[model samples]
Target: MLPIKLENIKLNQQYKNREDYFKKMGEQLFSAGLVNEGYSTSIINREEIYPTGLATGEINIAIPHTDYQFSRTTDIFITVLKTPIAFFRMDEPEKTVEVSIIVQILFDNPEKQPDILKELMEIITNQRVLKEMIAAQEPKEVLQHFQINN
Candidate 1:
């Protein structure tokens, strides 16, 4: 793991659409000098191809990511939307989603693979965890509630 913490991750208010969200996230990471120039575009492109939207039936989530080379350090950004954002489902490509949260992950190593997604999936899949996360108004509260053991 890198020296970066969840504190480094931010919930951007600038995102209106998926494109805007990613652009803003990339801009934040790039301007912070945490990633390269093409980082954001790469991740967003990969998201379009693979599609990370998850539908829990209660609260949907979008986990967008790329090939793990976009970051100078391994990190993740968690953004809670006051209003749900539309995304495409991973399993059903033709389906659309209304996601309440967006988690933008940057993996520095590809070997991490399913672990990261697995953890995220576990969190999002659990109604209890989802409720806690959604109820959290501040980023610090969010960081406090979610813990990554790996």
Candidate 2:
């Protein structure tokens, strides 16, 4: 299975903007000893240069992340927002997309990035899975959607 647990998944989170999302999520990961200090700021900086937002027709999403040096372990953290937030599109940085879900990826080894991302794309592109994630109230319900790879 993926290196994920109940603590790694947050449901119906409320945040004002992208910065708030990264900072708060970074804090949680830091508290868990999964990332170093300033990881949030690193993510913010990276997002400005390389936005992760993807438009999937029904539900748009963002996969925000930073360099491997900031991470202590490899894991995926997911947050389903109570309200959608606007993030710059990855394909067209000038344009923006309304994203309700945030998938924060952490990996200590740069080599693992592609394999991990490849696994994630399957779930992210599935509208049914995205719908289930937004509706999930419990952590187990959320995890069910991510275990397909393992």
The Cα error of candidate 1 at residue 50, in Å, is 1.1
Off by over 4 Å in 1: 1-4, 8-14, 148-150
Model 1 quality (TM-score): 0.86
lDDT by residue for model 1 (31-127), tens: 9987887987897788788888889878888888777667776677777777787888999978889888787777777877577777767666876
lDDT of 1: 0.74
- Over 4 Å off in model 2, which ranges? none
Q: Give the TM-scores of the predictions, in the order they appear.
A: 0.86, 0.95
> 73-122 in candidate 2: lDDT tens per residue?
99888889999999999999999999989988998999989988888888
Q: Which ten residues in a row have the lowest lDDT in candidate 1?
A: 1-10
Residue 94 shift from truth in candidate 1, angstroms: 1.4
Deviation from native of the Cα of residue 12 in model 2, angstroms = 1.0
The prediction achieving the highest TM-score against the true structure is: 2
Q: What's the TM for model 2?
A: 0.95
